[model samples]
Target: MHSSSVSGSRPCLHSFKTTLPLKALAFSTMMLPLHSINASKATYQFDTVVNQNRLIVVSVENPTTVFDKTTHLHGFGYDLVRSYANSLNVKLEFRTVKDNASALNMVKSGKANFAMTTASFQAIEDKHLAGFSATCDDSSVLEDNGLNVNLNWVFKHANDPLSQNASAYICNTKQNGTISQLASFYNRNVVKDESWDIIQRDLTNRMPIYKASFQSTAETYDIDWHLLAAIGYQESYLKPNSVSPTGVRGLMMLTHNTAKAMGVNDRTDPSQSIEGGAKYYDLMLNRYSNISYPDRNWYALVAYNMGPGAVSQIQSRLKAQGKNPNSWINLYSYLERHKASNSRYGQATQYVTRIRAYLEHIKSTPQLVNL
Candidate 1:
């Protein structure tokens, strides 16, 4: 959250008018020595040179609505500024405002380089700011009638140097490839569109099913029946009585050692095997807390299929490459890079890749949820 009030008043300057054109005024003002400014003017002359390379501080809130991991920041205001900076060869900095009020104040006080969010025009119009670029097209339904609340980018006073450059770029660029890639990733990960819903309906009609459990000391943990069924599908196509050539057993496919650690009396028991498998998954998730969620879920699934230590080694390699240790792309890329090598690391990468692809397939299909 942020305070609604401005922290301090802006300094006032005496009024002055310049006959010079905008570009000339900008050039003349920039040429004047930094400390030698004519202090009496209400409107200071703009400085194109100094302002051209200036850093634009774009603000967003935590749990940023602008850029989820799958969605690139380029689709949002961040990308707008980034493109501007690239064109101008200037620098851009991102600041996370504590909340909406702070974001508003940042624009009002000229503290922010620029600000955008899912912000409504009415909420910020009175601040003497320039609202350019509308982001969201519509608002949530209200009373069954279509309602619309526009999301916009806010700049300081209309001709503020930062605002000028940002506006120019926003007017020119069409959606970039970065935006498409991000949208694709988001669709794959978070937003299961209409196709997925249809698949879920079909799967429901089919009701392809399996079951598993874990029991120890007189206590029983029956896995979510559907989850157990999904896991069975992934492991052995719901083969309740199946056994791996490597000595894993049952519908959930627990090894004898894993069954022992989970206190499962029998690896062959469907209920026990499922329970042990789910417990092992829980343990993997706990082990990788530093990884982001949803992604962490994917990594844990991979680690469950491959060992945790092996995943840790891959994470180490990813960190060395300046990639996110927990990101699926980074991990997947590393896996592909190492797949042909005969080294132990290469073998681990191969295993992780297979597990990730399996998880991706499972997520893509509609047989599982609550993942």
Candidate 2:
């Protein structure tokens, strides 16, 4: 059978399909349900992968893979494939690969339709066949012979174990949970828990005093006021009298030197502190101007905590490794995989993550705005 042809080639950042027999095998494996193959293949003019009665996806077990302990078969790749399978009302068959070579070999050998590997694109490019990863956003799909085979290739650490059984990489998804649930596992649910009612109420009461400062400073910086508010709350519960053991003072917790650098005469003054912090944050955002949204904001928060110089160094290292240094997710992953002694990855992660959570909470609590 003559397979559909592809004109331009792009690196499959998140996913890819094979050529020749491998392509044929992918179609055969992915379009398992007879009903689907018979029902849509003719109209779509493509071998059914999404709406097929059965969908097959192959991936190696690693940190980025989403696996369910109860099911033990599906990982991150499974979750991604499951989303399509669920949407198409199809059944999914999850397959495993031993290593990067073996994972792609599944595609080459026709045992699996598509594969997911948490190995770096550069490593894959160096070791395996040719494939291009375009732009380095979240995930890139592989297109072959006009077939978009959904491959979830999450890059892995260099020191990660060779075998799934031996690997200790953090799998971010589980077979039992929905996509929202999986996302929550990684990004964390920012909403406030009702259990913290008293603390939240106290914080809500204190919002009015500094709300204007946050609003004005955030507006001046063209930033979300809630973000500044969240940072203020996290730093000192929005209290101007607060001081840290490290001698950082004020609602935004700037050290004496940083306060001077930002032209703030009083670090303990809520308005000056908020303005200085916002100005400093604006600087970080400008420095990482090329990074995309949400990720850029998250990276800026990291730079705010760990300093821009440290983040810049990490970004350079990421670029050297053929990864996008502008991506907060990629940077975080790199930091997690390769421990950074110069930067406080854990502390910074918590700081940014908590601020995000607080920001979400504040956004949801419009009543707090009234206060």
Candidate 3:
């Protein structure tokens, strides 16, 4: 027997004529090879091959307050990278390093798809790694006084257009997203009778403001001015003579232990205090990297006030309440609920509330720029 090709271009089957018993003929038909037939059917069924999308790994230095803010408040670079990956139908991964050098190496070795840190390209050679469209503004608080340190995004190369473009887009997106989230959160919690405008007015009226400086020095540590001011407002209202009941002293209010950890011998010196405070906050932020933003920030504040261990206990309580353990609001509410009954909780609440109020005041009054 022979079978004709459907298109008549080629023979589909071949057969040989032979004298055979009906039983033999049935056996031959049954034993005919089916592998070729299955292969042909499969070829027709799947005419094209689809390639898997490549995965991107974004790396960062040990999580700092800035990274916390970006991740928690702005969804770190995750939101942006995720959106891009979704569009391309790819996957995004994150890797973190203990320091800047390691983070750079990750990108250079192609172990990471990109590096996201408060890195300055001018500080390093640009040939090995590429930065995205985002420039991170590093915020720091003074040691003796809470002051703001603002640092701009740093990239690996000065001439890379891709890095520049990525930096611009990221900055804009972060700014818009942060503003929106802050506003929404504020509106939800703010009392109807408490005017944000009045809060702004009071903050603006506060005096003894620190001078803004962007320069790096042994004394100043080259922190961003605004960040320092924000810290100052939070810690002690930028009052150089301010002293916490716990003996944290100076404008940035450096505890003896905290100052010692940051290698500050002169806790009373404004410059030393600021540097120590900034470094300490950086350390605290790095310690809580897994906490995610808004929560990261919340936890950092809690750690700053009640200590990390106490915050952990509060987090457990928050988890029990079906609230996000990392949210500032939930933490704040929990602190309030526990303050009356729990001595440790009461102390933590007092500290956290003060910081929250100061942060809110700073956010509302841009005119307090002098501070």
Tens-digit lDDT track of model 2 for 241-322: 8998989999889988889999999988888999999999899889878864556777888899989888888889999989
lDDT of 2: 0.56
Model 1 residue 120 CA deviation in Å: 25
Runs of candidate 2 with Cα error greater than 4 angstroms are 1-195, 338-343
CA deviation > 4 Å runs, candidate 3: 1-209, 213-227, 316-330, 363-366
Worst 10 residues of 1 by lDDT: 7-16
What is the TM-score of each predicted model, taking all chains together? 0.42, 0.53, 0.42
Location of the lowest summed lDDT over 10 successive residues in candidate 3 = 5-14
Compared with the true structure, all predictions reach lDDT values of 0.49, 0.56, 0.47
Best by TM-score: 2
| Residues 1-371 of candidate 1: C-alpha lDDT, one tens digit per residue | 01121111111111112223334445665566666455412222124224555654555542212432221232234444454555555556666565666786876665665676545555655565555533212122111121112335565554444444444444334222232222222232232355546544543543333211322311333223443344555575555578989888876687788888988887666666666777887787788778644456556766777677878888898889786787654564565457677365454444443333333444445444332
Q: Rank by TM-score, highest first.
A: 2, 3, 1
Number of clashing pairs per prediction, in order: 3, 14, 41
Superposed Cα RMSD, model 2: 15.6
